[model samples]
Target: MDHVIKTLTPAARPPEAPGEVPAAPLRARPSRAEAEAAVRVLLGYIGDDPDREGLVDTPRRVVSAYDELFGGYHENPGEVLERTFSEIGTYDDIVLVRDIPFASHCEHHMMPFVGRAHVGYLPVERVVGLSKIARLIDIFAKRLQTQERLSSMIVTEIDTVLKPRGVAVMLEAEHTCMSMRGVQKAGSRTITTQFTGVFRDDPKEQFRFVSLVRNGIG
Candidate 1:
């Protein structure tokens, strides 16, 4: 099937420094009733009776589900790493949180892509709690994203908040849009990685991070 692509020109903005959080683009939001009405339209588009017994409440349920699925937009990424501990005596090494499971919807199709994220950072003097890193992953995962941009955003947020010497992030996911539709290839995984500072500058550090991610200490 052929797809029609529309090109949109965005408004110009001032330059942003590295690690600077850009302002979110403003958009007029529809009311809950309007949103529900839109869902009913979609139901009708799919050749279903929106007023049918089983589907009578489907619009409300779908809107509620959307609130949970896309809650990231309402969260603050900066607050996730607001607190850090700097008292560790000479502990300067990679802090890795592996096998963090997450689910996100694709921006193109809004289909789910489930995955595991492996995140690591070399602390300069302070470090945030391990659970905070997991929360950081969740903050981004609950939004509509592409795997590549997701990995970059995670790395950028950690680097900006923690000011680590370096950051390494790897995401492995299977997009349902591909498996359930399109080519319909099942059991295929897509892996994306982003490295900054030392991890990006030095091959050895990148290798160590990858090795630790692949083979945890025995």
Candidate 2:
């Protein structure tokens, strides 16, 4: 199947010198009550009584769940990576974190797709905490997204913020939209990987990263 690759620019920084594009305005979100009402409408549209004993509180519960599910919108990926440690000058090698679990709703069907993310980065001058890499994945996964776009976004965020020498990320997921509906192929899985800089230039390093991911080691 043909895949779409979107090339993203580096993270935007506040204008310090001059001639920078100002940040776009943020849109106001609907109130919780409105969101709950919308959910009820959707539940009713699907031929379920929103007022039924079992589902009476489902709308409110769904809205509350969304606060955590789609919370990536309210976060800043740049800020999550702002504090970096360059304490080691000569320690330049690959840093890989494997098997980070994540769950996300597909943009196309709004159904959940669960997965594990494996991330690796080659430090230029410094490195970030291992958990920060997992947090980065969480930031991107909690939004409605395609697995392809999600993989790209993770690499782009790390590339933009850490400014590493090279970065690599891989994600393998089982999309519920396929398993629970439509074609209903229960065991089908999608995998996406990205590499940058040296990881992209040198096949050996790319192979090494892939090997580490396969072996579940740093």
Candidate 3:
């Protein structure tokens, strides 16, 4: 009988080296002077006076805000998934968590794409703690992104870290870049989804996962 396993394969060993020096700790981020200058230029190009009192500190505030908004660029996602707990039982049903809210900055217009994510995975041998899923979402969402890429990134990260038999991710969001400007249509939401393994091949499984997220299992 062919076995369907979802275990993490051992990574290939690096070539044996003699006396490899320890790598240096990561250094602090580069100065924001360049970004500040860019902001000043943008303000002038947009016919706004940058030297006015109201706009005097705007560049500095924007620089500081961007650091927090895109802090995920500095985080290591694998470390977030390093710890795990094994579950013992014959019980194997879809584990779904829904309505995980996140706020991400749009890479295109630097506006916000606020949304909720629904994530599900079929356990192969172990289960991750619930909070970790939310943490993973936050880790990825804090970076500049678009809804489609963000949805796929969440699904791929969970698949890589957990090696689940199946994984599904759905995101529902409002893109302020579109609503607050350009098209200027509020109340319109964007939905993006990604699936893999059994969830990709089995429509029923995918539907079930979606139903559970949209409507509670109860």
Candidate 4:
């Protein structure tokens, strides 16, 4: 018995402006009842009795969980770093926030990849709140993502918003899709990084960022 899984194909989009992070294309959304119906279908596909007393509300619960898990789709990354402060006098160096814990679903499998992000930037004239970096990470992590793309998105947003002299981003994660399924190699971790401006241009600065992230010192 061959079963087909339906997927949504987004229409072609125009080219994005330089330095702009491309957003997910808009598509017609299904109603809550329709979403729950699909969840029931998934439960049936897994050979479970979705209508059983123990599972009767599973569809509703799953739908509600998904709403919370994928809430990033409704957020705007541009707004995350909107507020900046420039009061620091002549303090122009790397500002790093390491060990920012995050959880994201892999775009391919929708399985979770739990990780920590290390972000740093060389402030030019202004700086954003340290907490905003963590919030920015959450905004991107709550969406379907690849570690590489997620790293790039974070760097780009910081560079665009802060116009920093450099930006650095590193992500270390254990992808459940790999450990829980293929090869079943549990406890394996993946690392990804992105650099721009001085971080990309100078090996010394890049090494400093890496060393700082690893050693927790300049």
- Please name the candidate that would achieve the greatest lDDT relative to the true structure: 4
The clash count of every prediction, one per candidate, is: 0, 0, 0, 0
The superposed Cα distance between candidate 2 and the true structure at residue 139, in angstroms, equals 0.8
Give all TM-scores, in the order shown: 0.89, 0.85, 0.81, 0.89
Relative to the true structure, how large is the alpha-carbon lDDT of every model? 0.85, 0.82, 0.80, 0.87
Encode model 1's per-residue lDDT on 1-218: one tens digit a residue: 12233322223232232455786765666778988999999999999999999999999999999979977766666677888888889999999999999999999999999999999999999989899889878878888889998898889888887899999999999999999999999999999999999999999998998899899851
Candidate ranking (TM-score, best to worst): 4, 1, 2, 3
Candidate 1: regions farther than 4 A off:
1-24
Angstrom error of the Cα, residue 60, model 3: value is: 1.6
RMSD after Cα superposition, model 4: 8.4
Worst 10 residues of 4 by lDDT: 1-10
Q: What is the lDDT of residue 7 in candidate 1?
A: 29
Model 2, 35-108: lDDT tens digits are: 99999999999999999899999989999999899877656665667677878869899988899999999999
TM-score of 2: 0.85
**For model 2, what is the alpha-carbon lDDT of residue 142?**
83
lDDT ranking, high to low: 4, 1, 2, 3
Residue pairs in clash, model 4: none
